[model samples]
Target: MASTASESKRVVIVTGAAEGIGRGIALRLANDGYNLGLFDLPKAEPNLTAVANEIRTTCGVRVSTVYGDVSQEEDVKRLVDIVVQELGSLYAMIANAGICINRPLHETTAEQSDKLLDINVKGTFYSFKHASIQLIKQGKGGRLVAASSIAGKRGFAEHAMYCASKFAVRGIVQCAALDYGEHGITVNAYAPGACETSLLTGVDEYFSERKGQPKGSYMEVFSAGSALKRIAQPRDVANLVSFFVSDDAAFVTGQTWLVDGGSVFD
Candidate 1:
């Protein structure tokens, strides 16, 4: 069993907590009073230590950091073990570590496709696996939130591999929800569209190159395509995640909530 500073406090583990939507979710959960176990790649930028310190000081919650690639099985196990050993119990798991490779279906190599699937699909599965075991051992209800994408719901021209990986993640979330619900665990996913983050910067370049347009023009056109006529911020997606793991969302499970500002309504 993990050590616990306070047994009554809720504990959460967030993968990819170094930046973008993952970072936003971590901050929001900290503000909501959840003691955090943050996991990220070893050389992740944006300084996770700074974020952890901010949360600890501002939220007055215990914060732990684990450095590892979410796609690696050993790393995933280590992350969960650290959280369970240190926090004493695991209440929620957010599998938000993902990577994207933008290329036409024919242009994507087998290696590239496999890498995307490994990181986005298998990485998420490992997170769920370890977190579920820890939660069951703790003998308490738990929450599992995976990060799917709007691409998972609808395919884009150059996002074939990314879409496939996200679709698999959504499928996993649904299946896990059904299986774990019997154990009082709620599993769900969030699908965000065109979020304004560094991750989308590459997409802007890809579209600009394909269309022979300037980078700025490509993003403007893309934003206008959305019904909201704007790109989403990381915080917007984070807010939805915060709600899903909260007590208010206890009854919601096995669903994919879109945080796309009406980009894809089904």
Candidate 2:
């Protein structure tokens, strides 16, 4: 079948594409016939190239992987350079790299807070900055989809720093959307709820140690607060991101779509 204009062969960059939600988004975009440029740390889990190869073989789109820390400006610039050189042009950028460290506000050290802000907030800023500049240079506009969190919409206990970072992401996306609208660029964010990923592994360990329970035993406890009473999968969040990056979502910008299974209704 012939692909639509939005689904046509276009260059797309996905940060944190080594695993979890970022990996899912990369695969989905590939299935829609997007050439892929995946960025993540060199030590990222799940072997980014393997996932990229799988997409290439299965979806029949070119895939490239660049190892870099999104928090570093030089690294992000290198990533964009690779995408432009290898993929020809940039059409979409998904800023999905993030870290979560849940702890009481008092227990959260200054360094930990700084690292969280660096990766979650500053990293996203760098992604948007480089990708938007490249898209503007291309003179075709582009899509910018960022990963916020349900924590951004509403604060969670013992997650003060994480919540603050995600809230900052939403604010940034909104402002960028308004600023870039005249240029035909759209910026939006997804607020995903609890998901089963390595990011949560530390939280699980923390809870198990604190509550005297098995690591996975608290999955239900954490999910019960949501109206759906089920934790979301990474693909669930990825699917929403896929939609937002498509032409169908051109009319939708500066909006925060919550995919937490009704965890944050507002």
Candidate 3:
């Protein structure tokens, strides 16, 4: 498929597009008629390339893949620049690259907390900052989205580090929305619950070991806690992201909306 111009399809940069929810969002946005800038860590180069290939073959959208650590400011700036050079102007950015630490407060070291905050909090800030700068320069409105978790809304037993990072993401989202609203850019986040991703699997494994239960015990517990009695899929969260980057959400900003299968009520 030929590459579409920025005015025709709109271009979006989705960080951590190698797998899981980020992969789902990249595919969903491509299908939504947006050219995609797929970014992920170098360690995930294979999966990231596969995602780009799949999009080109299936969605036929102009998709470009770049590997970088979002925690680094220079890498993020370069990512924004490269995507624009390859796929035309940037219309939106999905800052979905994040990590989790499942340790009690007593065991959580300052080093672990620093790493988590650097990627989760600082990374989102860079994504928002660079994307909004380009959008403002273009003099056209755009979208900025981030990954928050149900952990951000309420505290969990052994998720002090994770919760602090996610809660900080909410603060960044609200403040960015206010700062960039005048430029016609919307900033929002999607807070998902126990989704069927590797991240959640890790959490479940941690809990299972701590409680001396079977492998899937924590997964089952989380599923049962939700009103739907099932864990969420990547596509479910992608659907919410689909709405946020679309014209329908132009009036909506500064929201950390929940998509947790009714697990955590605001």
Who wins the lDDT comparison?
3
For each candidate in turn, the TM-score is 0.94, 0.95, 0.97
* Tens digit of per-residue lDDT, candidate 3, span 36-155: 999999999999999999999987689888889999999999999999999879889999999998899999999999999999999999999999889999999899999999999999
Per-residue alpha-carbon lDDT of model 1 for 30-113, expressed as tens digits?
Answer: 877789999998787457888898898888889889999988989999998998789777899999999889999999999999
Top model number, TM-score: 3
Model 2 alpha-carbon miss at residue 243, Å: 0.7
Over 4 Å off, model 1: 1-7
Clashing pairs in model 1, backbone N/Cα/C closer than 3 A: 2-85, 3-85
lDDT string for model 2 (1-266, tens) is 11453355788899999988888888888877788899999986358978987997798888888998998999999999998899888988899999998889999999999999999999999999999999888888889989899889988888999999999999999999998888899999999888888877777787777889988765777689788988888888878987887778889999989998877788
Query: What is every candidate's alpha-carbon RMSD to the true fold?
Result: 3.3, 1.7, 2.3
Q: What order do candidates take by TM-score, descending?
A: 3, 2, 1
